[model samples]
Target: MPFIDEPAGTTPMTDTAAHGAASPWWQDRTPQEIAALAAADGVALLPLAAIEQHGEHLPLSTDLDIALGLVDAALPRVRAGVPVCVLPPLAVGLSLEHSAFAGTLSLRPETALAVMVELGERVAAAGFRRLVLFNSHGGNKALVDLAALKLRVECRMLVVRANYFRFAPPPDALPADELRHGLHGGALETAMMLHLAPAKVRSGRVGNFDSLGRHLAAAGRLLGPEGEAGFAWMAQDLNPCGATGDARLATPALGDRLVQHFARQLARLVEEAHAFDLARLDGGALDRAD
Candidate 1:
């Protein structure tokens, strides 16, 4: 659901009970074990997120923590039949948009691209055929997408570049207005953080920071910082608090629902990734689908 389009009719499967303790972390596995997983056509999940400002109410590691949490949640659900391993997440990403605020760090665009290319090379060298470039920070979307293409071309690895939220269906409780602001420090993100790491979430500081489009739409110029009309932006351009969206609408209960939703969707993706291949998708498949 998060990438281009989620394949329909994916069976929901999770067998960690039988396959538990198999060590899906690349760091936790020995070279021999890794080789075995690779031989089994394992997916190498590479999570990329940013350490940046998520308003004053949220911690700087909000994006990183949530992305990692999603990986943790999805791993258990991956069926025993599918081999999957995680590369430790890249903590810093392209976050110049949020650099106006303190505690926001970013990798230069070229550095980000180079690092991804190098990591993809290493993953291919490790004998893995599939790589998932899972990105959480919206700021990293462009570069990460480019990196996925690069990995496919250079490393010859089957790659999936996706935003974690793309897996989740829109929440029913969050109003459309609130959802519009969810791109940055809005309700969905705040809700998920509250569910994942509540202690780090500061209360009494939430509010509805208006979307930048609300100010610019009157100009009939669709040059906001998200979706088809999006471009580079400073977070302050949306709100001085350095986070857009309505955090006041976030709740831990909503966060729990969002987390479970994303995890379930991700499990299906890992399964699909295990079976997806470039070779099998030749004229026979493409001609019919296209």
Candidate 2:
């Protein structure tokens, strides 16, 4: 489905509707208003992020800010027919790998799972049948996958676990090796920060780090030649700065492209999720072995 841009002079539904405005923000609506919105088949977007170190050049809230920025950019682009409610972000996630670094706050994997499950349950109870777990941090991927599965069974809701970076436009200016292995505090992330929050980025402090080599070494050990299996590793093990990739190559122009690309894809996902048919699936059709 194509993204629908609002026509000029048209105000958001939030400004004119009594069932809470069409602002697409959960925090902006009252409890009663939310109840009404839930009854209207609104989809709830919950941003999952981490408060961790992003090297000396970037602020600790890099993931959190990027998640929120993506949401802010996408909500407006959602088709007018889909009513979306953006929930306040869960900033602290599973970041134990980065705990060795200062300014890194993390929750254990189990704790993070519990928090996400409870949040999903609460939102499901609030009359929302669609919940999107929008994650920005790499460490939170496993937690989100688990939560999405359990929430589907327990809450009986359509849960979507989306990683923002997965929607980013491929970097043409950077090398394929760097783009593939630079998972954190890298050129992609730094550029995103430059576009979303330039004040928090220390451009002068940015430098190159060789995380790709470490990542490959770890992958070779944990993952077989086919890259099927995985092993555990810490952020420090990858690089001294607790970051990967080359940050010195980050530019505001690249950041803008990334942000816009991610936002557009995210908006499309939200629209599709809102229109998904949860009742059509045949749960009993497949055998466990199949």
Candidate 3:
């Protein structure tokens, strides 16, 4: 069944089990608690997402919700007593491609990079040695990678940059063509939104963006990780609705499956970050190759 239409943000976002209900959020923790956690090899998860259009259906926070929700869901799956804290979401990111659409917001690339570094520096200053930059928006991908490298050098922290969707393989149910064409505002995103925040997903507003398919096919270009050659395109270049892909096939059932799968994979990723040590890269690491 389709979700009932509701205004954006009608549903509350997920909170954390990594810290537990007593102090589920990083901002809620006292300075002593934070420092103690940092000393325990704590890994800080920072979610970066864009406030942008997702056709006429999904909320602007779609990316943010997924990033945050996945973090929230994954936390408990981590073995008990692992020190990981999720910061409040950054909320806005690089959305230049969707800037033409109503309700879209973006930051300049340099500003975005600076903000990420500044946040990482503060985390390090607080004695944390690890940072996980969890991003959900496509536009933020390259910048997130750059931010991780910058944090590695500038903040002296073990930084891991990643996208939520990349953690798990796409569900086998998704068609092969969609694997390439469903770039944004597609079945995958819509389904996730349907599962994560059903109230925010408008019923019967699904749009088809086969035009983007035609455009991509004509250019002999590819999108996403499985590509050889990529093209520079704004969200509107391929679709007027500010959407691209076959969202008509999306369903809450599929969304539920994705949420579980993605959350499990993300939990594993967080565990890896928690165990990783910055000191491992020291001791003349650059001079040695194994």
Top candidate, metric lDDT: 2
| CA lDDT, every model vs. true structure | 0.81, 0.84, 0.80
Give the lowest summed-lDDT range of ten residues in model 2.
222-231
User: Model 1, 84-118: lDDT tens per residue?
Assistant: 88998999999988888889999999998899889
Query: Once model 3 is optimally superposed onto the true structure by TM-score, how far is the C-alpha of residue 54 displaced, in angstroms?
Result: 0.6
Query: Which residue pairs show collisions in model 1?
Result: 2-166
| TM-score to true structure, per model | 0.87, 0.86, 0.86
Residue 289 lDDT in model 2?
37
Evaluate candidate 3 by giving its C-alpha RMSD to the native, one decimal.
10.1
Q: Pick the TM-score winner.
A: 1
Clashes of each: 1, 3, 0
61 Cα displacement, candidate 3 (Å): 1.5
lDDT of 2: 0.84
Instruction: Please write out the lDDT profile of model 3 over residues 1-290, one tens digit for every residue.
Output: 11145466576322343444656468987676688788888888888998999889888989988887787788889888888888888999999999888899999999998898898889999998888888899899889899889888777778888797676555586886765678888888888888889999987788777656556576765663225756677887777887878888789998888888888887888888876644566654555443
User: What TM-score number comes out for model 1?
Assistant: 0.87
Give the TM-score comparing model 2 with the true structure, all chains together: 0.86
Model 2 Cα lDDT, one tens digit per residue, 40-97: 7889999999999988999999999999998988988998878888888999999988
Which is the better candidate, 1 or 3, if ranked by lDDT?
1
